[model samples]
Target: MLDFPNWQNWIEKPSSIIKKLRQKLDQMVGVEIKLAEARSGPPTGMALNLEIRGEDFNQMSEAVEEIKQKIKNIPGLVDLTDDFDRSRPELKVIIDRDKASRLGLRARDIANTVRTAFNGKKVSVFRDGTEEYDIWVQLDQSFRSNQSDLSSLFIYTPSGEPVRLSEIARVDSGPSYGSIRHVDTVRTITISADAFRMPGPVLVMKTKQVLNKLDLPQGVTYQFTGEDENRKESQIFIGQALIIAILLILVVMVAQFNSIALPLIVISSVLMSVMGVIIGLIVHDRPFGIIMTGVGTVALAGIVVNNAIVMLDYVIKLRKKGYQRNEAMILAAAVRFRPVVLTAVTTVLGLVPIAIGMDIDFSRESIILFGAASASFWKSMALAIMYGLGVTTLLTLFLLPALYSLVEGGKERLRGLFSSKEIVY
Candidate 1:
């Protein structure tokens, strides 16, 4: 954290720096890796989280000894652990579809019924003299855990004839692995063999590199999609908003100053502000989220133009006082330097609360008018502000002045020649 930040109370400094540093470290690696394994073979593993095409669980197992050896050798590895090898869970269950049909049911229906029975879905409750008890209707636990007993469950058809559930469906058991899901798609799980001293990104990258060379089983597949998806979506949104924002900013400034040429000068500072944004993202290694992109871009519109406005305001005064164009620009630049710097700095400092994810009461109507948003939204906003202001301030106060002096001087000279014929009357 910079000591001379706009807000200077030295509260919550450590967390902010830590957050920034972690993001930076993550960017140095080629890619993040993820892998998943499940009980394999026929019946299409996909029924639960059907295996992805091209990912070979069997092939991955073959490399386990090599993986184990390398992991042990790596000095950077802080911790290596496994969820399998005695620690592994039993995912095996057999559904007798034929037996289920005999009971006028499907295997899914039985599984759902069994899960519901244990979970105890509430039916209703009647309060009796303020001593209320919950009323639940579900299958008894005895019926769920026992496989042989399950085959003995009785089912009655519409004809009122009693029949054994085993008559229609078969019952069996096997081991299955829990899945890691993405957007409702159960992809694969990355078993983290190491942590501690190992950099999080390096482990993720190396695992993927080795995994890539190996061939996967015919149908099962695996791939990596961690922050990449998040980053893509953010870039798209930020990119769209960025384009629209630039256009809108031009519209607003052209509308405000009512001069096409002047508006061009005004808009140049926004581009300069982006230079700061890139520096910040590089410095902090932020992923350029849509929220950050939007906030930073919008901030560019406001913060960047501050210096331009100062210059413009001075130019207007000189023009109104009937000064020559070239001399007026140079004077305006000199005159407007102080307030422009102050304004940009003040705005950045003012938004520090939002950048740090600090909380303020927004429960009551009074606080709502000026209070923090919910945690997630507030955090995104704060990051937007923190990054946006820092970037915009640098471009606006320093680089913008140099750029403005050049662009404005040329425009001013052209305007003078064009208006030279104006009457002195």
Candidate 2:
């Protein structure tokens, strides 16, 4: 997928259309904005990573708070989240030379000794599963005791000297640099998240506001990127493809019907399918989530169009073969019943995979979309097609009869135009 390498570049680069749209978004429903990487991980496109940093724990916490505010203020984002404690690592102590020399010690000694105390070194080595494991013995919790013990601890010098750690430098504990997690490496020191209620333009605007408001500290910078970015690219590409597909369907319908008006009537049955899908979605109380709404909408159109074509083609064939309009309509209905039933039933069966929410992740939103897209959903879809199809059917059955009757009744009126009133029965 194409990702904006630098969202900052795009955000900073002036676009009149984008600016105007943003203004309207501000005036209307507002927007949700965010600053994240296009993807996390290394450049190989094989992973994702999030690296967060803060001046101090307090500063880190403040930065996090700022992120929360940014997320909340985003226009359509809701349920902002991240993996809890995913980036959180405990304090790890590292020594400073100047401070250590002021007392009488070196950084190496403190580092080495502390390493042994916290993370022991290998005193023995063993082999297991074609791999080597180094084992060592060292002081545990009760022995190390507290920070006071670190100062009181003694270390040996290269000159066969022993000195108290406090005499050489300060002993402290603080947050560590690296973070740990299950998935792609996302190491954050101080970061926050904001999710929007909707995707597309709404999320973009909200994120814009956040980026504009951000006040960066010296040596601190950020970027705007995430799944939202991925979504935007996908939406654009799919939109074009969908337009092409619809045009193709229209062409196919026109070719089959050979009449612009009736073809239009049949093609429009797609709308009934859409209405039914929407009603099902609404009744099931599912919001238009990222995945569910997109695929479901496209699928609905095909279902409706296919159904209409079956019925219309049969009726048109009968009419072209010299049967009276009403007779043709009834005959078409009788002949098409088996095919129509088979098609509808098969389509519903095909939906079983969808009903299982294959695309919707195992998240709360997924459940909502799937539950809302309940079994009765097909019924709603059928209702819309039924309305259009029923109307077309009735017109087909009654059109020729009505026209003939009207012409016969007007025979008297026609006599005025004929000089020799010779009428043949």
Q: Pick by TM-score: which candidate is best?
A: 1
lDDT of all predictions: 0.54, 0.52
Q: Which ten residues in a row have the lowest lDDT in candidate 1?
A: 42-51
> Which lDDT value does model 1 have at 249?
71
Question: What are the runs in model 1 whose C-alpha is more than 4 Å off?
Answer: 1-231, 256-261, 278-297, 316-322, 351-425
Per-residue lDDT, model 2, residue 249, is: 86
lDDT tens digits, residue span 1-425, model 2: 23443322354322344345545555544335323223212222111112334334445445555766666655544334433342434544545567566555676667888778766877898899899988897777776777877776677766667777676666556555343332233324423343322434455556556656877554444443454445556577656665676778888867765656555665455555555555555665544432335455565556556656666667667768987656766676667667766666565555654454333435445543332223332433333333333333333334423433344335536776685677789
209-328: candidate 1 lDDT, tens digit per residue: 655665545564544343333444667877777678778877887887777877777777677666666665566555444554566566566656666776776777897899766667
TM-score of each: 0.49, 0.46
